[model samples]
Target: MKKKKAALLIALVMSTCTAIAQQKTPKAVMDQFMDKRFGMFIHFGPVTQRGTEIGWSRNDQVAQADYDSLYHEFNPRLFNADVWVKTAKDAGMKYLVITAKHHDGFCLWPTAYSDYNVANSPFKRDIVGELAEACKKQDVTFCIYFTVLDWHDPDYPIHNPHDTTQSKGLGGNMTAFKTRMKNELREVITKYKPFMLWFDGYWEKPWTTADGKEIYQFIKSVDANVIVNNRLGKVNDKLDGDAVGDFLTPEQTIGKLNMNEPWESCITICNQWAWKPNDPMKSLKQCLQTLVTSASGNGNLLFNVGPAMDGHIEGRQVKRLQEMGAWLKLYGESIYGTQGGPYVPNETYGATRKGNKVYLHIFQRKDGTLSIPALANVKITKAYFMNGGAVIIKTDKDNYKIELPATLPDENCSVIVLELNKDAVNIPVIPVKA
Candidate 1:
């Protein structure tokens, strides 16, 4: 009886330790990921040939038979991994996430478990492998985007975005599906050595909390250092909690000022996630502000760009990214390695800080002046424009005003540096009028 009790205690202790291990990521790894602040999200596949959205277009916009067979002619002869990685690097991106497998169940790399992979396609080259090598050569971190829901696989329960006749989580071999998923993920982790796994398509009823926990633990067992996003379980559009992953991923929008947790916003450069001819792209001003706002809110930005069928990024999009790189070259000090504000961000301006210096990012001004709530305990010792000019500062009892020049240095976002008397990070988050 005593032996049985001792065994039960040992089992409980081991289970508790495992749970704790799976829940937390290494601080060093988390810090490194957050410090990057910017990355490239590549959403490319056979769907690029049809000029439709990847995965979701199957059985909706395009016939399932036709969409599934597009891989036969998926020959991206111009797809150069070097060019892709270089494009990201030139755009001041520190990392890259390519879609290894989307909801269509099409795999970019040759996987033993799936016949619907790059090996069978006319291109016949390992897209993920090449990208991984290219990222390494360019000194950029390589990551993978794997979706949890496979619409193409017989084992996976969900299918047909437009088909209401068939219900999810019915008539599918979930056990076999999970085994295949584990096998493919194991291959991805051991072979590619990705720094992170960006998961999606987990909100469907087919995937559950238990499944998410299992997959999360499985990935950690393979590589404890690799980071996972919040989509490993059921999460709302805002990416609020109750999930098993390393960080929060707020898709297509900037996350709120959240200094307590790590988050990254995935937004597209264009309207579409996959390439389309003559697609409208965001202007340089819009792009720069998106990045700046993300940084000002204490979050990272994973800006997406979809390569065309010919495996080249759109020239116009590339030019816009280059413009952003030029701006970052001048004012990157305000964004990189800095934590979000002593003062909470508002419509007119936002703030970021590192050490004793506070960077005030003025997105707009009224009558050549920007006003924000006054800091309670910190004193501004010196103030200057990040570009190359002096700034006039006037402080009242409740608020402070920064008088701007007639012609701002940067039309996209003008940055002002404020040297504080104490460590800016030590100051509590101060709310300002919107």
Candidate 2:
């Protein structure tokens, strides 16, 4: 009898512990993402307009000098910084990351180190400067995507043995190369003071972990607040999907499950990473569902819309984002500033909670009810679709379910709000008797 009582007591204690853990708060993912729930990832260059891969040559190849000549004629006068920043604002995005320098080595700003920049173009003006000014006007956090591997620069080579052209002007100390690159970093960070430095091209041969460390340390020392991506290291396993980066960056899809730290999933609405003409845009419903799915999974969503070479966002991308803004502006309470809650069974809807109330996002609504079996000792007091006013929840304790009305308001992704009041507070717990 004593052994049986001990086992039962242990079971009860374990059950209570599990309940407490279910309510535990993870990292400060929301605090980092509330203002950054959405952001624009811009991929644009002269190559983007030419219908070519952003930097890769089609054949074994084009002459470096010939390919580099594209920038001389690279003129994007119609590139409206206001339109680009406004599109992000209208789309409910508060941050923007633009490719200040792609692999091709053409600088958007006039760098003192390189003449291969926007200043040399017929449209001789600093586009990045304009973008910084525009983001400041609209209160959007502006960031730079810098690809350290520069193919067009005379100092750096492509690093492929098969191509002899890649080996030119190659005799230089790695320390000198790092020091020179650090100069560009200082120039950009000092001038624009970017919110982030999206460093890429770790595999592009010039970048080494040692080289990256020099750059990373330099930037952080300048402004400790700037958030650097995990690419600076050999992809951090913690922040990368496999613990890499400062945070997890799931490219082009909603990611696999992670509860340790924050995650951001980025996907393009169109086929190309950079702006393409008349590209088919994702529907308003699709965009809403993507954001909902990401938010419910305890992750942030960064929706990508490539800007045209003219520097303005595609019209379709702009319109769809505006529609998303309108919907989120109306029904965003459940998503923004909430934590994912409870070990909900797979069949029921996913949940996000704030204080006593929990939100149920019904991706696949059942015929009559949406149930939550694990939430016990709590009484649900309210129910309603997000866009419409209040409704009621007809709960059955025996079945452990919350019955919905006959029809759902939004078919694509309907959200139900449930206000729950804990019953244990009303009655003291009595120790179990064996």
Model 1: residue 45 alpha-carbon error in angstroms: 0.5
lDDT winner: 1
Tens digit of per-residue lDDT, candidate 1, span 318-409: 88888898888898898888898777776777788999999988877567777778888778999999968788899877888888888777
Off by over 4 Å in 1: 1-23, 237-241
lDDT of 2 by residue, 219-284 (tens): 755664566666665654464232223556777887543455667777888767766677777777
Highest TM-score against the true fold, candidate: 1
List candidate 2 segments past 4 Å from native. 1-30, 33-35, 57-66, 157-173, 240-245, 341-350, 376-379, 389-400, 405-407, 422-434
- How does candidate 2 score on lDDT? 0.68
Residue 407 alpha-carbon offset, candidate 2, angstroms: 4.1
TM-score of each: 0.96, 0.79
